[model samples]
Target chain A: MPEVLKIKNLHQTFEQGTVNENRVLRGIDLNLEAGDFVTIIGSNGAGKSTLLNSIAGTLPIQEGQIILKGTDITKLPVTKRAKNISRVFQDPKMGTAVRLTVEENLALAMKRGQHRRFRPGVKSQDRKFFKKQLAQLNLNLENRLETEIGLLSGGQRQAITLLMATLQRPDLILLDEHTAALDPQTSITVMQLTEKLISEQHLTAFMVTHNMEDAIRYGNRLIMLHQGRVEIDLAGEDKQNLTVPKLMELFQKHVGSGLEDDTILLA
Target chain B: MAIGVYLTFRILDLADMTAEGSFPLGGAVATMCIIKGINPILATIAAFIGGLIAGLVTGILNTKLRIPSLLAGIITMTGLYSITSRVMQNAANVSLLGKKTVFTIAQNWGLSRNNAVIAMGLIIALLVIMLLVVFFKTEIGLAMRATGDNPQMSAANGIKTQGMKILGYMISNGCIALSGGLLAQNNGFADLNSGVGTLVIGLASIIIAEVLIRNLSIGGRLLTLVVGAIIYRLILALVFQMNVEPSDAKLASALVLVVCLTLPNFHLPRNLKGGKQNARSTKD
Candidate 1:
């Protein structure tokens, strides 16, 4: 598969050139191929979200280039990057407008990158298409299209958000702990839905998760980050054969820290 | 009936100072036109236009200068006192006294002056409410509402949040100006210090309407606000009727607002499981 996303010598720092300046990322190099599912695992403030944000163009990178599908979008603005890359934020509510109806939110999402005018009417055909898409989630949201998103449960809204993010078939989908707000069962459901959407659409995806088991289980490749650098980059049969015990052993050997945290190890 | 009008005015959330100036300004303009041998209907139109201008100024100050909405309104209102006085030709007060007011014109057309004022107010309110309702249903309107609720989200969605903010202030101030114009005409004079403590009255009206209408639907909520404004005015009228000194009127208005601010804190029984009532109480 062709490389869909490439990050070359990426560097990012928070509060740069001040007494409180802290370097978050240092000389990070990474690449993602088409239809690749990669899970990122890191401890707190490990620059995982920052990396994703950099790629999504939410945060401006301090140094280095981001090449998406053979195009350099390093200095592009957030609105411009939105056309090629979509994001599901850690907070479920961040991704969608809570006050708006689900259908209205979806309509806005569909119109992303398209010039919108005061059309005064919504076509029946567009409604039918939206219904068909919502039906695929099997969350009974197809019937609740007119209901305000604020009334929906966090998990349901996240599902709807995920659906909306992928509606345009963006070149890359960034899942920044998208299921973190959900209950365990709902989280599992959303994760399954995400995996299905990624595989079926053949879309390149990067999912950041604190859960070690999910990181090892969900994706074809698992990348572990320590102190702003990639500590482990396992793939294919090696990634599949890697057990939780072996992963813990590798973390101790590589990062000089045991994977003992309940939040990280429990998953 | 008086309570209903007062409550409706409160719900409209206009801050009421515009009404103080605009109501009297409307009266001054209408009565002046009537004295000039102009048609009563046309005089009323002129009054409404005067109110619109007042609202426009307030909106511009708040939106363009990044001034706080309340401060911007207060400034506009203070400035309007002198402007209205000048418009009335340096007269501290303009009185219809014996001239044909819009009310008298309606009376000549076989309607009572009181009935005419009520009809005119309702007609203008209805037109405004309809336009707002339709606008809120449109894309731009949605963007505007979102800007009011969460400006950051609107900006992220590529909506011009600044423009929407300006538009909201303009619409709000415009309604207030119109109400003021109506009040002035009804009373037959524009008093220089008319808009004093207008904000409190508007807030009181808003609170009362929210208390009456429990639903969260945007249209329902907006209608409730109008109802609140009317109720707030009626309460003031009733207080005046109860032998309260005219000098203590501002004090009475302040007390009404204090009660309104406190009323939501009074515990009410929850009717539904996971009802908003419980949520609201907790928030308070």
Candidate 2:
């Protein structure tokens, strides 16, 4: 399969030219093949989310070229980039409108590109399609189409958000610790749902997570980012058989002794 | 007439200011057309268009200029003040006392002037309410509401939030201008300063309506806003009837607004504490 996303010599600096100037990503290069799932692991402020934002066109890159499906998208604005990419945020509420009903939210997502038409919300067929999609989550949300999304638990909302993000099956999907806000049990369910959807849709996905176990367990490839550089990139059987101890050994070797915090090693 | 209807207007009134200019602009344009020998009904339609244009200006300033929404409204209103005055041939106020006002036309059709004014107001209000109710049911409308609720999510979902904001401001101000226009025609004149302090009255009405109509339904919420506006006007009339000094009217209105805004803060619900704690933790 062809490369779905390519990032070359990417650099992002916050507060550039000021006293508080901080360079987040420096001379980064990455390529994602179509239908490839890549899990990125890093400590706080490791430029994980920043990298995702750069690709999604939320944050402007100081220097780099981002090509999505062979088209240069580095200079594209966030709204234009949204046509080819979909994102699910850490907070469940961030991905969906709380005040609107599930059906209404789905309708907005469905009308993502064709916004000029002034038609009444969700047709009966669209409602049925949404219902079928919601049923796939197995969260009993199928019957609750008219229920306000605010009434849903965080886990349920995240699942719905996952479903919505994949509704159109864009060229790339970005998941920024989407299940981080839920409880452990709910997180497990959401993670399962995430994996299922990514595989079923054969989507090219990039997910950033703090959990080392999840990084090792899910996705076909695992990458560890440190100081704005990719320290480890393991794939295929190597990534499949990767253990927590091996990841810690690799992290210590590449990132030096500063990341020896117990929480990180245990995570 | 009923408490429910009264509360509906209150919710609507909460979102005021743009309405001040809009309402009077509606009245001014309608009256201007009537003066030019246009039919009373057609004049009302012209008033609606005028209000829409004012709203469009405010929307453009907010979205294209990136000015804050409230500030955008204020700028449009101030500009409209001058434009409305110029449109009326530099007269700060124009009276339809002997002209073919909507009221006069209604009277010619055997309706009393007071009855005609009330009927006209009701008709215009109903049309606005109906259009908005239907609009809110559409995909664009949902996206527009979502823009207000969570702009980031709307943008992330590929919705053009800037365009939606502009469209929202336009619709809101358009309704306001329509109200203003109708008010001018009903009262037989348009005054440049009539929109002054009108935002406060609208806010008071919105707050009052929300308090009265606690139901969270969308239709209930919009209806309450309109009712709140009417109740707000009735209360003002009652206050005038109580022999309150005309000079202190503005002061009283300001006082009412201050109380309404501050009252909700002192009585935060217990459940909200958890959300606040979550917010604090997130900051940490």
Candidate 3:
């Protein structure tokens, strides 16, 4: 299997050389193979979002090289990287343009990396395809094609954001705690939808979550980040059979310290 | 004219003072062009291009140089006063008493001067509105709208947000300048103080349109701008009929806007159109 993404010697530091200097990511290296869905688990103040931001090119790369499909994208701007990488932010509102209609948002996503021309937006022929895609979500959003996204509920918005993220079938999908803002029921629905979309599209994805159950239940692989480093990594049959207690034992065994707070992880 | 302000203020979310400078700049440029024997049609275009340049300056100052948008517009507007004077050969007014304009050309086509001016304004406004409607529906136009709607989302979606903003400003100011040119020609001269209170008029037109037509489609919204302008003019005429002093007209327009904005929120007499009955029925 070929590697779809590679991060070499990644490092991120905030307020460098100052009294409040905080080193978030320290000499981390990660690689994701094709069709890999990796769930990252970490405690608060951990560099989960920082790593995702670094990958998405929102944060400047102070010291690292990010290669996506053999291309050096370390210096590419956020929008340029968006051609190959689509992101669903933790906040549902951050993922979409609230003022635009659903069809208009999808129209934007459809032309992700393509050079935008003076052609009519949401072409007549493209409407059928958009309608089909929206219908597949089973949210009855097909009829609300012209509705502004701001009018949608939070859960509905998150679901649409997920759909928009995958509209262009990006090389990598970054979900930065995408469902963290939703209610339990809505979160489960969105999670199930996330799983369905990933498997159906056979996509490579990086999902950062605070919920250990989610980190363990989904994804073929799980990574634990502790103090700006990869503390433990599990995959395959091991990840399949993993539970809360077993994962805590593994964390204790690997890090040589008892798990400090299981509640944060459990929740 | 109001559409330019509508673009920057309502759409782009930028309160640009560039219109104050560019409006008169258009008049200065067009009057000078006509004085120099240029064709009337081409002179109006020159005025539009002049406004485009003014808008571009403000856009660059705000985007490239990191000046705040409001200050950048003020800087450009302050500088334009001198530029407009220079364009008018340092004269306070550039009269077109013996000069031929688009209005004059229309008169030569066998229309009365009054009819010619009215026809020219109507035709040009209609044509510009139609073109804008088409332009806003295009992909580039969508991107521009998206840029204004949310810069962060736009950048994330691979749009060069700064460039879109600059382009939006250029289009906005260009239209404003064209209106300025028409105003100068129709009124028979370009006065140095012609741009005064222009921003207020533009804002009033936009507010009136939005109040009159709520939640309209994009095309309908654009059309409402023209209607709003007409309505605003009518209100001004009424104010004049009420024996209001000419100089106090700005104060009167501002008060009209205040009333229109607040009226929708006020609870009026219930028996009018059975407002109470509808409220009770809907509650059920």
Give me the candidate number with maximum lDDT.
Answer: 3
Native contacts present in each candidate (fraction): 0.09, 0.63, 0.63
TM-score of model 2, chain A? Answer: 0.97
Clashing pairs in 3: none
Evaluated at residue B60, the lDDT of candidate 3 is 97
Q: Would you list the C-alpha lDDT of every candidate in the order shown?
A: 0.71, 0.76, 0.87
Task: State which candidate, 1 or 3, has the greater TM-score.
Answer: 3
The order of the candidates by DockQ, greatest first, is: 2, 3, 1
**TM-score ranking of the models:** 3, 2, 1
- Which scores higher on TM-score, 1 or 2? 2
What is the two-chain DockQ of model 2? 0.57
lDDT (tens digit, per residue) of candidate 3 on B1-284: 99999888866878889999999999989999998999989999999999999999999999999999999999999999999999999999989888999999889989999999989988898888888878877887888877877676677778788888898899999999999999999988998888987888898898778766656566777779889999999988888899998889779988987876567556443322332232232222
Q: What CA root-mean-square deviation does each model show from the true structure?
A: 5.1, 3.8, 4.8
Candidate 1 per-residue C-alpha lDDT over A1-267 given as tens digits, one digit per residue, 9 for 90 to 100: 899999999999999999988888987899999988999988877789989988877688789999999999999866677777877877766766665678777776665544446553234676798899999999998888788776788899899888878888888988999888889999999999999999989989999998888888898999987778898999999899988788888888997766556364455
Write candidate 2's Cα lDDT for B114-198 as tens digits. 8877776676666666777677787877877677656777888888888876666666655666666667776788777777776
lDDT of 2: 0.76
Task: Please identify model 2 stretches exceeding 4 Å from their true place.
Answer: A262-267, B1-20, B104-110, B261-284
